[model samples]
Structures are given as structure tokens and as C-alpha cells.
Target chain A: MPQPEYDVVIIGAGPAGSTTARFTAAAGLRTLLVDKRQELGAPIQCSGAISRHALEDVGIVPDDEFIHEAIYGFAIYDQTGERHVHDYRSLKPDEYGSGPGRKPLGYVVDRRRFDRYLLTQAERAGADTWLKTEGRGYTPTDDGGCTVHLRRYNQDIDVRARLLVGADGLQSQVGKWAGLQTHIKITELAGCLQFIVDRVETEGLLEIVTGHEWAPGGYAWVFPKGHGYAEIGLGVIATMTDKPARWHLDKFMTQSFFRERFADCRILEVQGGGVPLAAPLRTQYADNLILVGDAARHVNPITGGGLHTAVAGGKIAAGFITGHLEDGMPLRDGALRAYQDVWLDALGDKMWKLYGIKTDIFHNMNIRERDEQLYATMADYFSPTSEFKKI
Target chain B: MSKQQPVLFNIGWNACINCGACVAICPQEAGFVSPFDTIAVDRPCDIACLLCEQICPVDTITHVPAPAPATQNGAGVR
Candidate 1:
């Protein structure tokens, strides 16, 4: 039997794909999400930290099932271990008014479960999902729709879609298949290594450490999970490191601060990955294609945070998609370019300014000067929530 | 330069997620890793940097040793 044609087919079931699928499917478009893994969120690759407002903006209400811990605020430490804290409650009263859920500034969640939950939302919204499926390429139909070639488990088949949304992450094959330039320059890539440490005491404070002795172009972080669990990792700018990222991470793990904290801890998980520092793509749409999330280079150039952007961008894409599909616009019509314009208008300026400032101020300065300047303008980093840009 | 062997076979087929860390951390001046293409390392360019192997997040890369001269098995077995 042949698979039913879909109005919209999204590749990758991550936050962006799931959110877009939810919105599109809920709006009555036949949507399907395809993932390479049998499970939705295996091989977890995120730091699992997100702001409360960001989560709320994405329509995720924190639940114990996936929400690990509440983060009141986070702190930054210089090489000498002198700390500067960003207390959300005290610092951003105007932005985040007193409320039941607004007290805790953010959350540390089980990213794997959170990702899966997002998939469930999409499924509940009437979208279908194919697990262990991979998209090799697509051939455009005469109607401007595409016959997407997919390999599901051991079988090959062609699925049809009028519009294709690529949320396939930093190494998005969908973007490449659509003939989009998604290559990240080496100098703009940040290498990260993390360990889930158990039996570590966390004071409910998320720690961001800055120093040349550790991560030169980037920073080290300790995001709490609970009473005795947290994720400890450091990201190194490629231009500053000569050896494997693990070598520097290992040194960081041995530091007196980390050593004392994790002395009684055992490593429960390991995660390594890279975050792109490029500004949002100049063009995020082509033909009948739309790219969202990390695939569109929506990650923060300095903090590397992208969850909010992924969710918001997906929502924005879904809005445009809904209009096109509902308006009965043919696949060949130029309406799809609206997605590109809307997204660029929504995110292009913020991304460009952030990337420029990050490269000029953070990347160009000495570690000491960087820390000094960051401390001087404590609100500059987190108050406006500059790193966590929304769509 | 000698023809370099395929050091990491099927590097991005399944487990590799194309994080771009390998490219950023490659010690070789000429080494390149991309999900779009397969030529990650080459003769004189790599110089056996092996940094890609060490830094791969999923550890999907492996090196295959070059074959020795094919001799009479009985004499070479020792």
C-alpha cells in the first residue's frame, strides 16, 4: 500500500519540528514528523537549561515528569572564582512580574523527556510520526510539491508533501538537500563536552564560569538537575583550542571548585556537540522549503542558547504555512517566501547585532577584560535576555 | 604523497549527528569534516592528526590498518 500524501512534511522531531507539527496539525493540515532515532529524544545533546519565560512562550508548562529543577538565577565566575550573580527575581522585577510560576527564573529539565513530550503534543494534535526514518533527498513535482524519498527501517518509499520544513538541527541534511548553504565555519563553531554528575551538591544556582585558563572563547557551566545531580560542561571556541575538547574539559573537571563539588559524584551520562555561532541565515526559505531552529542558525552567537528561538521560529513558520495552505495557494505560488521575510524580519536584526557584539566584545577581548566588562554591566547579559532571542 | 586510506568509514551514516565539532577541533590545517561530503582527511593534509577521532561526540570513527604484503601464509604466520 502507498503512504498517504501529506500537506506538510517536517524532518527531525526536535523542538522546532515538533512545535511546527503541533501547530500545523492542530490547524488541520496533514502533518507528519520523521525522525532518525526509534525514540524521539535519545542521544541527548543539550545542556537542558531554559528560561521560564522562554518555556512559557513555547507553551510548555513545567511538570515534574520532565522538569528536573527550578533555577532562581545563575552566576558567572572569573578565573579567580570571584562570582557575579544574575538574580532574576531581584534583577528583572519589571520584566518578570511577581507570579506563581514566575518566581523561579528558569528551569533545568530532562531534555530527552522534554523533547519527547513535545513530540507527544504534535501527535496529540493529529500529526503522524515515523520512527527510525531518514530522508535522503526529494524530487520536486510539477506542482511545486516534492516527492520525498525516505528510508524507513529497511524499506524505501516515496512520500509526498507540498511543503517541507527542515528542523534537522545544526547539521541539517534537509537544509543541504534543499540546496541551502548550512556549513558552519570552523572559527564560528563552539565545541562542547558535558558530564551528568551524580551526588553533587547544587545550591540551586546555575554556574557559568569564564576564564582563559579554562574555556577561552566560550564558558563552562553547571546546571543543576536536583539535590544530587547536575550537568557540568565547558564549551571552547575552536580558534583558541589546539587539542581535543575533552582534554580541556578534563582539566576543568579537575579544578578545585569542580573537584570539591563533584568529588563524591559519579558520571551518569556524557554529551558532546558543537553549537553554531553564525547569524541567522540570510535566506531560510527556498521553493517550497522552510528551515527553522538550529538548521536556520538561530542559536545565540555568545550563549549558544536556541530553545526559545526554535519554538518561536517554528510557531512563526506554522503561521505562514497555515496561511498558504488555508488560502489554497498552489505550491508554486510565491507565498512561501512570506515565511522567509517574516522570519528574517522577526530575527535577522537581533541575530546580526548579537553576533556582531559577541564577536567584537567577547571574542576579541582578553579574558580579564571580558570578565571585567561583563561584571560592570551585569544586566547587559541577562536582563534584556539578550542571549535568549525569540522569534 | 601516498594515497590516504579511508580512515573513518561511513563516518556520518547513522550515529554521526554533524555537530561540526570535528571541523572546529581538527588539529590538521587541511583536515575538514562536513555532513555534506565524505573526504574528511587526506595525505599531507591530515598527517595522522587523529583529532577528529578523539573529538567525535558519538565516537563513530575508526581507523583501519594498512594491509601488509601478501606472502605465503605458512611462512609469515610466526
Candidate 2:
């Protein structure tokens, strides 16, 4: 029997792959989305916070089923108890919403549900999906296509595709197979760990804590998850400290302020993964292959956030590939250069600037010093006046 | 007495959450032992760059020198 084939084979069913598959499949391309996990979003790795603008840009309405809490502002805390608050409600009506009521700045979601919802959207748009399917490797074929070798249920399956996409998160092997530079340096990688806890009081504000004492080379966060629950987590540069992220988190929780506040809180769940804090990959595509989401290191360097970029990058990939396919154009690096150019103009430019600021502010610092200037710089970067805030 | 030609690391599977940080940054792709048990560093391609060791959040990977190489007689090898 002949092996099944598709116009595009997307490895990973996360937001990036699903969003890309949704667009490509909807555009009448034969698209397939696969994930190694039996379930779409099990063993969640994200903090699940996404900006309202990001969701709007991706055309995904914030449904109540996945939205855990509505965030209106941010409260940034320095090492020495200094607090700075930015409230989105204070934004001019034109800057936020045209409606009578004040709109939320962002939402903290249940990531598992949010991811599942995205995959469901792609499936509804006519993308084929396979669970518990792993992409072991792939080889470029003649006529500018590739054959993806997947393992499902101890069975080997090969599917040929004109285009292959890597949306496989931080541990993506697709980019490696395509010979794209996907390796992250130790200093550029942030090891993150989060705990779901209840009885922690947080209003509508996402609390951000910055200090070498707390997170070393990264930062910590307290995001409300509604119903009096919250996710308190932190990311640390693995090379900056001899200890692991869990140790830093444990020590952070024992701080006098957190100790008293979280004394009665119950630890409900734990999640952890690595986030690439490096600048976006210089090249995100090769011949007949493209990478989206964390696979392309679309994450924010300073904030270690990628949900927004993942969605946006996926959309761009879908548009670029669909337009090329429709034109009967060859899927070569020269043609795919447009994807890189457009993405840089839209989002990558800001990320590049943030990456510079991140390296300057976070590396080789005095961990004990209360650097108010550093905090001010961070505040400015995220402030309404900053160009990065536009993303 | 026996000689050791290669060094291999043993992964503490109990402590591993299979987050794949080791696999992501490994230059030689030496961290993955299998599709199901991907946490083990069973590959002989290890250059001892120690990036995987530093990147592991749980410190579950430990460098354990492989047992001595077999002698000419090969009777002492376990």
C-alpha cells in the first residue's frame, strides 16, 4: 500500500501547531497535526497567562471554560519590598477598549483546557490528528518534500509532505532534523518550576518579583487563577546557581512575606520545563521546513513568555505556506525568507530589543544588591510608552 | 586491573520528570535512551559537555564512568 501523504505535516498539537494547522487546513490544504502524548495538553508546562491583545490578534475569544482569572494590571515587587503597580484601567479609552466597561488587560487560563480547545479548533477546520504519535525523524525527499517517520503504538508510519512544521515546544527535534540551529546554550536557557496553590490572596493583578535573591537570572510570578487559587512560580538560569529551580522556589516560599501569606495555602499540583531566553533564531526556516512557537525560540527573553508569539508565529507560518502553495511556488529558503521578514517586522523586532535588555540587566549581576534601577528599566520595557508593549 | 575507554552517565529515573531539557540542549543527542524512557543518558556519544547536567532541573543525571574495558582474556569482565 502507498504511504499516506499531506501538503503539510505539523508535529506537535500545542497552540503553534494547532493554530498553523487550523489555518492551513482551512485554506484547503491536506494538513496533519500530531502529538507524542496520548492527551493534547497533559503535563502542562506554561503559567497560562496571555494578553488580551494576543488573543484578539489570533481571533480566539477568551472563553470562560479556559479562563481562570481576568487580569487588570501588574504589581512589580523589587527585592527590598519596593512595589510598582501598572493598572490597565488607567489607560485611555482608545488604548484599551471603546466599550463602556473597562476591559481586562489579560487572562490567566487553564492551559490544558486552552490547548485542547485550540486542537479542537484545528480538527473542526478539517485537520487530521493523531494522539500518542511521535515523530522519530524525517528525511528530505526529491521534488522538495520530506518523509516524516512517526512511531505510534509500536508501529512505524511514514507520511510524505510537501511542507513540514516544527511546533514541538522547547524539546523540539524537528528543527534539529531539518538542520536548523535549535540548540540552546545553558546561560540562555531558563529552568522554570511552578506550583498550583490555593488560599493565596491576589486581586486582579499579576504580581512579578524581580531580584537575584528570588530567581537569580530570571524572575518569579504570582498569577491568580480565580476562586482564591494562584500559580506561584519562578525561572532561574541553570548556570547562575549551583542549586536547582525547585530549591530556589522552596527558599522563596519560606521568605518571611511569602511564608506568612502562604502559610495556609495548599499545594495542589506541580509543573516544570525549560524556557529559551535567547534571542529568536536568526533563521526559522529551511527548504521545505519551518519552525514555529518555542521551536523557533519565539519566547520573550526577559519575561520568558511565548504564548503570544506562538499564536502569532503559527498564523504567519500558515499564511506564508498557504500563499506559496496556492501560487504553486517552490518551498525553498529564498521563498520562505518572506516569513522571517514579516515576523521580524511584526513581533521579532521587539523581541530582539528585549533580548538585548535582558542580557544587559540579568547577567553577571550582584545577587544581593537591591537594584532599583534594574527594576525601573524592566518597568519601562513593559510600560505603555515602550514599543515592546505594542506586541 | 582493567582499563576504561568510555564514560557513560546513569540517569536517576525516579527523580526525572521526563521534561526533556537534557534532550533539547544536548549536542550529541546523547541524553535520550529510548522513546518511552527518554531520561537516560545511555548514548556513547557523550562528549561530557555537561550542558545536560547543568540544564536538568532536578539534577537527576549523574556521570558514572562505565565499567573497565575487557582484558585480552575477557574473563574478568562482569
Best by DockQ: 2
What DockQ class does candidate 1 belong to?
A: incorrect
Off by over 4 Å in 1: A89-102, A256-258, A330-335, A362-367, A370-379, A384-391, B1-20, B23-78
Give the interface RMSD of each candidate.
Answer: 6.1, 2.2
Per-model TM-score versus the true fold: 0.83, 0.92
- Model number with the top TM-score: 2
Winner by lDDT: 2
| Prediction 1 TM-score vs. true | 0.83
lDDT of 2 by residue, A173-249 (tens): 78777677777888888888888998899978888888788887888889998888999998888878999888888
